[model samples]
Target: MMQELRSRKVEESSAREDVHTAASGDQVSTESGGRTDQLRTSGWAAEGPSRPWCRPPPCFSPSSDVEVWLNRLNDYFAANEVPQDKWVAVLKSFVSDEVYVVLAEEGPTATFNELAACLKKRYGSGESELMTWMRFARRRQCPTESLEEFADPFGLCNAAQTFQRFIDEILHGLNFAYAFIDDILIASKTPSEHDGHLRELLQRLTNYGVVINVDKCVFGAPQVEFLGFLICPEGIKPLPTKVQAVLDYPLPKTYQELRRFLAMLNFYRKFLPVLHERQQEGRPPSTTSRRSRHRSLRKV
Candidate 1:
């Protein structure tokens, strides 16, 4: 009976010890789990919060060309597929002076396209293709001279004289070298001659206190694209891409359109020797013109 009682106590002690071990294991696991969660939270906190889906647009200054700024905004809105109503508010935030005032005063019903049209009428140059070509052609550099500072903004006009006459006088005085607005193209038969001319040009620019964009300057190249023409050992020729713009022009339908097309063609008539003959052949017949002329001649 005593042996049986002792065996029962021993079994009770073993059961309690097993329960204690299980409780300790559970406590350890819970503590470890809590620590893991805390570490995960800290990691996310260190990385910073997630960014919002939509960001504000890049802003522009008042001096910037309104047409250019409007185009950029249009592109951005199209790409983002932003709501049309929000465009005025976004544009207002980026613009000031007359542009801002115009947008602010526009009625609530106004669309972005209407606003763009208003801005275009106010600031667009409306330059014709030929005028644009001439503007570029006026800046073409000769073989010997390389120029600098062609791209100064309006605000810096005082600092750099971007006027055509001023640029022309400077180049004309330099001899063997010339500038197209700000680009200087220096010509020389030998390396030593080129260095001398370049030195002189630099000295002249320095004397006049002209600042050049050094990063844009190219030196000693065998060929360079000046204006729209490419100059090399083979000689100057119209850029194929530029010529393609003319060739790809659609046929004119209206009389006014035909006049404009012919006027543009006249500029290149030297290259198109048979253009006048072709134009005469394409002319429509006049109503009874030959018979009327014959009657008038008989009366005379």
Candidate 2:
């Protein structure tokens, strides 16, 4: 019994020693391998913990102050010509269920002035009955008719009726839109679904020979960059391009041209309204100070 007890004690001592040796071995290996380089680094921290001491702060927000940081970052990206190729991928994964829409309607027979006016009223500067007519005039397989002929103001059930088969099957559950000067795109999950919407829109646009850039297209992201601005699956953010486009716009050389621009900015009233009225009235915005002018015009 005495011999057996002694043996058990010895065994336990050996086990403890082995555990100590193993831990000691790891420490020695870490210290020995660590290279001392000229570059400054948290070398002590590197050897210390398996986990980091602190996580990085979040990178973005909605305030104008935060915009300064983003502008710098975006500027770096733009100046480098480093195509934000991965940007699309990041946005796709971020907002996976969003969709973007583009509408392309053809002119069946309306002349430049009348069709142009209808386009303005229905889809242009204001969302009026005429504006709704723009939606009808551009919808997929929309019937060919003069704006005057439509009994329904919006035209979902007017001269150009919404096709039951198309809407019931496709575009049933998609939201989000991106409108260019003459066309609009509806974005969503499964390029296949979007394709269905596109086919209808394009059929009309094809008659007009309008070309769409498929490369800039994306689907199934919780967030996406559209018309050079970020739109989430649920939220709407007007692209910087949309706003900048307004600011950089040149004063028209003629009264008619001024009317055209007025028609254009009429829809952007929320962003800059009374001032927009001034611009519409033919006052040239001086390059030195648009902001002050914008403020002055607002007071007026």
TM-score of 2: 0.25
lDDT (Cα, tens digit) per residue for candidate 1, span 1-300: 864665565456545655775787743223334433453353311211232111112212122111112222333221212122332232222222111000010011222233234334543644233223222222212112211112222332221322333455445565555444455556555667767777877676555435565556667666555544555555554567767868887776554466577776665464578998777654545564655544433332
Clash count, predicted structure 1: 13
lDDT leader = 1
lDDT of 2 at 42: 23
Whole-structure CA lDDT of model 1: 0.41
lDDT of 2: 0.40
Alpha-carbon RMSD, candidate 1? 28.6
Stretches of model 1 off by over 4 angstroms after superposition: 1-162, 263-270, 276-300
On residues 214-273, what C-alpha lDDT tens digit does candidate 2 reach at each position? 554443445555545566765545576777887899866554565577677665454454
